[model samples]
Structure formats: structure tokens, C-alpha cells
Target chain A: MRFWILLQRDVLVAWRKKSNIYQPLVFQLLIVTMFPLGLGAGAQTLQKIAPAVVWILALISTLITLENIFKDDYEDGSLALYTLSGMSLPVAVIAKAAAHWLTTGLPVIIFAPVIAVLLHLPASAYGILMLSLLIATPIFSLLGTVGSALIMNLKNGGMLLSVLIMPLLAPVLIFGAGAVLETTLGNTPVGHITLLAGCFVLSLTLAPLAAAAAIKVNLE
Target chain B: MNKIVKFYHEMGSPPSFYRITGHWLKPLLILALLLTVYGLIDGLFFAPPDYQQGDSYRIMFVHVPAAWMSMFIYFIIGVSGIIAFVWRMKVAEAVMMASAPIGALFTALTLLTGMLWGKPMWGTYWDWDARMTSELILLFLYIGVMGIYSAYDDDPRKAARLAALVAIIGLINLPIIRYSVEWWTSIHQGASISIMGGNSGIKEWSMLRPLLVMALATKFYYLYSMLHRARSYLLRTEQNKSWVSKQFIEN
Candidate 1:
């Protein structure tokens, strides 16, 4: 009950501070746009590199948004207040991570096809690309939450968060990219998407508790 | 026995570890240097050239040990990381930090030696072979751990905890590296020695003996190097403590 309320509060806060959500989206768009320009607008080249470019940009954007996840709240002492609240801290972490996914990741998924079309990816690849991103982005958000919670109190948190999360994100990227590639190649993408969903579910169940524990440790 | 246990506990203390073990590093370093020289010489010259591979098979002396150590060190790092995460043992975290750079170096060596061997054997210096790619991923994981730790300017303990998490997550790549040939159509050769079955190829006892010695020497070298770096980590982290200051004065 309180978790839903807290999640709503977080979403409202993020909505009010639209820049936090828009910055990463803009960065993702800019990066995805750069490929066509740099590679000379060839539809074939764009189609060939589209999946990798989208996956990599998605990774970078998720990582960039992670920098502010806990840092701003911790600096403002909102985390302490949340800790002092009667609700379970892990529940609170889950709520916050959920809200983060809604604001940052959902938009990325919705916007992926626009970027996909720009890259000249066929309509056939769209469903798998969207599905993989839909499943995989939350995993990135949740994993990024853990990294953010762990390093929330550190100096220069941005760079550290990137290094810590990038390798962990490799498996997600591999499977997600694999799905897109399979779709592009006219192969069955259901298996790869299932693997991506499995990864997302695994991360969703485990990462919030880890992030909550990390936050508690950092606070101490 | 209690007193010896206390001594061992004290040895885990940074001051005592540095005082007692730091001096022994030089001999081990010299031994590692000598073994490396001898292994290279013996492998390059005296070991009879392979009938199938001719002189190029000599790369195995370096390549095999490096590849083995890369996996071996990840296991060590993961185990130590688990200890550090669960027990909050500073020494275990120190061991992990020490092992990482060495592991990365060995992984790099594996890649280099694989490329060198691949050129003559596979006709290309690089291949997207499963084993080679996974080995590359291992190197990236090592870099990620080390880079994250170094990026944390303050609170190394926190950094260690986070790095430990990263290490555990990266363990997925290890099995992939080992079983890559079986799982995928890898250009790399299958295992020559299998515990589950008899040797796939007969290696002469004479060649095996030196290879085994070189492997043991490399293992010892990793141990000695890990202890040295762990001691250094202890010193750096405990520099402001009275025990460290007192030990330095006493020495």
C-alpha cells in the first residue's frame, strides 16, 4: 500500500522535474541519429548497424540517467526520511526503481521504433526490438538502481557508476542484441526474447533488495 | 595452539603481515623471473617440436598457463569476493583487489598468445571463436572491476563491496569461456586433457613433467604476487593507524 503511494510520489516528482527524464532521451536520440549521418545515409549500412547502435545507445542513456537516481535524494536527505518512514526500505527501493523505469525506460521503449525506422531497420525487426527493449530496459534500470545505491555517497559517482554497471549490462545487451539480430535475419526471435524476459525477471526480483541493502550500508 | 592461532590472527593484521611477509617477496620475485626464463628457453629449444605443429606448438607453454590462470584467478577472485561480501573481511577484499590486475594481465596474455598461435594455425590473428570472445569478455570484466574500484576516490571498503558484486555477476562468463567450444562452433581446439575421459592425445611424459612444473610455478607466482599486493593494500589503508606506525618504527 505504502509502496504504491511512494511509487506515485516518485513518479510525480519525476514528472515535475521533466529534465531528468528528457535529458537521457535526448541523448539517446542524438546518438542514434549520429549513425546515419556518419555512415553516409546508406540504408543498407544503417540497417546493418541499427541493432548494435540502438542497444549501445540504450545502454549509455540508462547509465547516464542512473547518475541522478539516488544521488540527488541522498544529498537532499530525502533518503534518510524515507528510511525513517515506517515502510520497509526494500519496498521503498522497489517503488523508486519502478518509478524510475516508468519515467526513463518506458519512454525509451516507446521511442525505439522511431529510431528504428530512422536507421532503416525493417518493419519485421520492430516487434522484437520493442519487446527486447521493453523487457531488457527494466533490468538495466534495476541493475542501475543497485549501482546507484551502492555509490550514491561516493564522490564522482557518475564515472564510477558507469564502470560498475557496464560489464554487468553485457549479458543483457548480448541477448537483447541477439533478439534484434535474429528478427533482422528472419529467424525466430521468440527464444531470445524469452531469455531477455527471464533476465529481466531475475534482476527485478533480486536487485531491489540488494539496492536497499546497499543504501542502508551507505547511509551507515 | 591458542597462542599460534593468536599469532595467525595477528598475521592477518596489516602491520604484522607487512613486517613478516614483505621481506620474502624478493626471493619469490627472483624465482618467478628465473622460472619464466627457463620455461621459455626449454619450451622454445629443448622440447621436441610437435609432429603436427612443428615449432609453433611451443606457444602452448605460455598460452596454456595463461589461459588456465585466467580462469583460475576468476575463481579465486569470486571466492574471495564472496568472503568479503558476507564476512566483510578486509583481507579477503585485499586479496580480490590484488588478484584482479594479475588476472587481467593473464587474460591479456591469453589473448595475445592465442592470436600469435592462431596466426600460424587458424590463418587469422583474430576469430569470433566462442572461447576467444569469452576470454575477451573476461578481460573487460576485470577492467570493469579495477576501473570501478579506482574510480571511488574515497571509501575503498564500499568500492570493494561493489566490485565483489560485479565479480560475482561476471562469473557467468567463466563457464561460457570453458564450454564455448562444446556450445558453439569454435575454431579453438578442444581440451587435450579431460578428467572425465582418457587423454584425447598422448602427450609424452617428458614434456608433461616440465609443463606441470611450469604450471605449479605459475600458481606459486600468483600466490606470492597476491600476498605482496594484499600487504601493500593493507599498508595503504592502515597508514594512519598506530600499529602500522609502531611497526615501522620497530623495524
Candidate 2:
């Protein structure tokens, strides 16, 4: 009951702001547009690197809005209230990350095909690309929640948060991009997809607890 | 048994930890230095050159040990993190925070020496090989741990606890990262020397001995560095405590 209310409350709050929905999408489009401009719009080169380019862009754009996951709650004392409310903190963390994924990760997944077409990613790899993103981006939100909670109380924590989570995110990038690249080359992407899904499952079970512990430390 | 338990409890106290580690510091440093000098000499000059790669393979004396220490220190940090986070042991917190920079240093040394070794062996200073990529990621994990510790400057306790959580998370992820990188690709040679690999392991006693000695040397060096740093961390964080003040007067 509390989980749904918290999740609904977060979604409602994000919906009210509206920029929260569009900012990351715009940021994703702007950067996805840069690859063609900077890389000379060569279809061959763009297709070759498309999987990596798309995955990396997804990683960074999600990162840009990660702070908003916990920043407002931390500042307005809502996090403390949640802590004191005797509701489970990890449950709240999961709701917050799920809300973050709905607003941020889901848009990127939905909009990824446009980026894919722009990058000349082959029509063959499109489904796998979206599948990988579906698995990968939620892991990003889940892991990002832990990083965000850790530094939520600090000034200039944005860059530190990126540095903190980048190593953890590298495997996600490897498997996610590798899946699409394998598909582009006409190979079975079963292995890459399996590993990517494994990463998501691991983060799903463990990340909320870690994020809750970090939030408790910050509240202290 | 009673004495061991008593000593363990005493070591958890900050002042006792500082004093006990102080007593062992000089000997550990001396042992590390002596073993390092002996290992490098024997490995570089005394050990027969590798049949395939010749003397160039000698870089393993330094590279292999530093790589071992890099991973070993992280294991220690993770264990200390659990102790710190669960028990809130002050000594464990200091040890965990202090191990980060040392771990980072050894990790960097491993990468540097591996690159130098790779240039001759693999014809490239860098490769997206499995072991090397994982080592590079290990370096980043160390940097992240150190970064989180330094970020919360105003509150040492918060910093320690938060960094502890990060270390624990990294430790859990370490195997996943290693597996993913290994699955991605592998060009690095398989482990040449393993204690239990029997026939598949290093057969040449001359080469194996120096490598083992070098490994022992690095362990001593890590202990020396970790204790020295943890003492300073303890003194700084415990400055207001009466024991910390008394140490200055006694010294």
C-alpha cells in the first residue's frame, strides 16, 4: 500500500514539474545529434559505432537527472520524514528509483529508435537494441539511486556521483552494447542479453538496500 | 585462547591499535625493503630467462605482486567495511578509509607495469583484454571509494559509513565485473603460476621462488602502509578524545 502511494506520489510530483519529463529527452536528442555532426555523418562509421554511442548517451543523459531523484526530498526534509514514518526505507528507495525510471529511463527506451535511425544502426539490430536498453536503463536508475543517496547532502556532488557509479555501470554498457553489436554482426545475442539481464536482477535485489543505508548515513 | 581474545578486544580501541601498530611498523618496513631488494635481484638476475620471452618476462616479479596486492587490499577494505558498517568499530573505519589510497596506488602500479610488460609481449601498450580491463575497473573502484571518503569533509563518521557502503557494494560487484569482462573477450594469457594447478602451473623453481618472495614483500609493504595511514587517521579523528591527547604528551 505504502509502496504504491510513494510511487504514485513521485510520479505525480514529476508530472507537475513537466520539465522533469522533457529535459532528459531533449538532452538525449541534442547529444545523439552530435554524433553525426562530429563524426562527419559517415553511415559506415556511424553504423559501426552506433551501439556504443547509443548506450553511452543513454548512460550520461540518465546521469544528468539522477540528482533530482533524491535531491528535492533530501532538501525539503521528506527523506527524514520517510525515515521516521516507520515505513521501510528500502521500499521507498525502490519506489523512488521506479519513478525515476518511468520518467527518465522509459522515455529514453521509447525514443531510442530515433537515435538508432539517426546513427544508422541497422534495422536488424533495432529490437535487440531496445531490449538491451529496457534491461540496462533500469539498472542505471537502480544503481544511480544508490550513488545519488550517498552524496545527496553534499555540495557539488553531481560530478562525484558520476565518478562513483561509472565503474559499476561499465559492465552494463559492455553487455548492453555488446548485445546490439552481436546482433548487428548477425550473431546470436543470447549471451550478451543473458548477462545484461543478470546485471538488472542483481541491481534490483541489492541496490535499494544499499541506497537506503546511504540515505540513513546522510540523514545522520 | 583468553589472551588472544583479550588482545583482539584491545586492538579495537584506537589508542591501543595506534601503539601496537607503531611497535610493529619499523620491522615490517625493514622486512618489506629487504624482501623487495632480494626478490628483484633474484628475479631479474638470478632466475633463468623465460624460454619464450627471455628476460622481458622478468617484469612479472613486480607486476604480478602489485596486481596481487591490488586485489588483496580491496578484499581487506571490503572486510573492514563490513566490520565498520555493522559494528561501527572505529579501528575498522580507519583501516577501511586508509586502505583505499594504498589499494589505488598498487592498482596503478599494476596497470603501469602491465602496460610496460605488454609492449614487449603483446606489441601494444594497451588492449581491451579481460584481466587488464578488470584491473583498470578495479582502479576506478578504488578511486570511487577514496572520492566518497573525501567528499564528506565536515562529518568524518558520515564519510566513513558512506564510504563503507560503497566499498561493500563494489566488492559485491567485483565478481560480476570480472565475469562480464572475461565474457566480453580475453587475450591475456592464463595464470602461469598457481599453487594448486599442479602440472599446468609454473614448473621452473627459480622463476617461481622470486615471484613468491616478491608477493610476500608486497604484503609486508601493504601492512606497513595501511597501519601508518590508519594511525594518522585515528589521531586526526580522535583528537578530542583524552587518549589521543595523552599520546602526544607521552611521545
Candidate 3:
């Protein structure tokens, strides 16, 4: 119940503000639109590079919003309060990651298709692309929490966070982009997507505990 | 259990570690330098060049050892992180943090030599191939640990604790990342996980001898660097303590 309440509170807060939801979607769209102009209006080239361009933009969008995951709570001293409450820090961290996925990851997932269309991603890749993003965005949020918790006291967002988490994000990038590219190349894409799903499951199970520990050290 | 606890207590104290490692620093460096010479001379001159790529394959002596050190040091950092976290071993924390830059150095050397070797062999300086990409990511992981550790300059102990946790998390992910990179590359390029293993690859026993020698040399070098760096880290960390003052006077 406390977990759901915290999740609802985060989602509601993000929803009420609206920009926290829209900014990353807007960022994703802007980058996707730029690829056509930046790389010339050639659809073939656009189609060729679509998987990488789209996946990377999705990752950056996640980074854009990951800044606020714990910074706000940390700044207001609520992070300390959350830990002090009887709810338990790991559960609270899971709730926070869940809300982050809902607000940031969910929008990125929904906006992915439109961005895919804008980037001229192949029609066959569309489904696999959506599926890959659906699995990937939550992982980005979950892992991002660990980095965010570590640097919450420093007062900067994703600058250090990027360097801190880039290596961790590589496998996600490899699978998420690799899945789309596989489908675009007309392969089954089952393997790549399966690995992405596996990482998603793994991160879901372990990331919160790790992030909880990070937050504990930062607050202390 | 008592012996293990005793060993832990010995290393748990920074002054004791500083004293113990300080005594061997010169011998370790001399050993690392001697092995490096033997490996280089034996590999470069004594070993025959490859039948295919000729002399360029010799870069393996440097590249392979650096790569091994890169992965090996990260593993060391992870284990040390766990020890530091579980037992609050001060030396382990210092070792974990100090290992980062040295790991990054080895990773960079691996990448540089990889690029040089790639130019003649793979016909390009870069490919998104799994080994290279994962090696690059390993470099970033090293930087991440160092960056996070340094970010909390106001509180070194807390920084080490948090960085230790990161190292532990990263250790868990390292193998998974390596496997994923190999898998991803195979899917994209149809390349095998490693190109240097077994008989089908770079398998000349003559070449293998030097590679093994260099690998041994790099281990000593890592120990040399880790001991020196950890001593400095301990000194800086314990700078406020009277033991450090006594250490300088005694030295």
C-alpha cells in the first residue's frame, strides 16, 4: 500500500507538472526530426541508420528525465524522510523507479512509434522497435536511479551520471538497437529481443536494492 | 575463522597496510620491469613473426596483456569493494578506488594497440565488433568508478563506500556486458566471441609463450601500481592521523 501510494504520488506529481512528462518526448521528437535534415533528406540513408538514431535518441531522452528521479526529493530532504519512514528504503526505491518508468519511460515508449515513423524506420521493424523500447525504457530508469542516488548530493544531473552509467547502458543499447536492426534486416529478431527482456527482468530485480544502497550512502 | 579474522584485521588497518606494502614496493617494481623486458625481447625478437600478418601480429604481446589487466583489475576492484563493504576494510576501499585509474590506463593501452592492430588486420581503425566495443565500455566503467569516487571530495569515506557499491554492481554486470557484446557482434558481423583462443586462431606456441610472459609481467605491473597508488591513497586518507605523521618521520 505504501509503495502504491508513493508510486501514485510520483505519477500524480509528474502528471500535474506536465513538462516533466512532455520535455523528454519533445526532446526525442526534436532529435528524430533533426536526423532527416542533418543527414540529408534521403530516405534510404534514413532507413539505413534509423535503428541506431532512434535507439540513441531514446537513450538520451531517458537521460534527460533521469535527472529529476531523486534530485528533487534529495534537494527537499524528502529522500531522507523516505528512508526514515517504516516503508523500507528498497521498497521505496522500487516505487520511485516504477514512477520514473511510468512518467519518463512510458512517454518515451509511446512516442517511439511516432519517432520511428519520422525517422522512416522500416514498416516491418515498427513492431519490434516498439517491443524493444517497451522493454528498454524501464531498464534505463531503474539503472538511472542507481547513478542518480550516488550523485544526488552533488547538485548536477546526468553530466556525471552519463559517464557513470554509460558502460551499464551499453548492453541495453546493443540489444535494443540490435533488435530493431535485426527486424529491419528481415531476421526473426527473437534472440536480441529475448536478451533485452532478460536484462529488463534482471535489472528490475536488482537495480532497486543497489539504488537503495547508493541512496543510503549519499544521505548519510 | 580466527585466522581469516586476523588477516582481515591486519588489512583493515591502513597504517599496517601502508607499512606492509611499502617494504615490497621496490622489489615489485624491479620484478615488473625485469619481466616486461624479458617478455618484450622474447616476443619481439626471439618469436617468429606470423605467417599471415607478419610482424604486425606482434602487437598482441602488448594488447593482450593490457586487455587482461583491464578485466583483471576490474575483477580485483569488485572483490575489494565487497570486502570493504562487508567488513569495512579500509585497505580494500583504498585498493578499490586506487585501482580505477590504473585500470583505465590499461584499458586505454588495449584500445590503442587494438586500433593499430586493427588497421592492418581488420582493415579499419574502428569496428563496432563486440570485443572492441566491450573493451571501450570497460574503459568507461573504470572512469565511472573514478568519477563517482572523486565527485564526493567533501566526504572521501562516503565516496569510497558509494563507489564500492558501484564497483560491486559493475562486477555483476561485467560478464553480462561482455557476453552481450559478443552476442551482439556475432549477430551483426558473424564474428566469434574471441578471435585469439584455441587452435583456429592465433595459436602459434612460440607466440603464445611471449603472450603468456607478457601477461605475467602485466600482473606484476598491476601489483606495482596498485601498491604504490594504494599507499598514497592511504597516506592522503589518513593524513590527519598521528600515525601518518610518524610514518613520514620514520621514513
Candidate 3 wrongly placed segments (more than 4 Å): B1-8, B192-205
Local accuracy of candidate 2 as per-residue lDDT tens digits, A54-86: 888888889988876888898988877777878
List candidate 1 stretches off by more than 4 Å: B1-11, B15-27, B172-202
Instruction: Report the Cα lDDT for residue B179, model 2.
Output: 87
Of 1 and 3, which scores higher on lDDT? 3
Model 3's CAPRI class is high
Q: Give the TM-score, chain B only, in order for the candidates.
A: 0.85, 0.94, 0.93
* Better by TM-score, candidate 3 or 1: 3
Candidates in order, TM-scores: namely 0.87, 0.95, 0.95
Candidate fnat values, all? 0.25, 0.80, 0.86
lDDT of 1 by residue, A1-220 (tens): 9888878988999999999888887898888777877888989999988887888787788788887788889999888887888889878878888888999899888878777878888889888888889888889888888889877877677876776666567667777887898788888877667767877877877788778777875775
Global lDDT of each candidate: 0.78, 0.89, 0.87
Write the residue-wise lDDT of candidate 3 on B174-227 in tens digits.
999889888877777786434464336756688788888899889988898998
Identify the superior model by DockQ, candidate 1 or candidate 3. 3
How many collisions between residues are there in candidate 2? 0
Give every prediction's interface RMSD: 3.7, 0.7, 0.8
Scored against the native two-chain complex, candidate 2 gets a DockQ of 0.84
Clash list (residue pairs), candidate 2: none
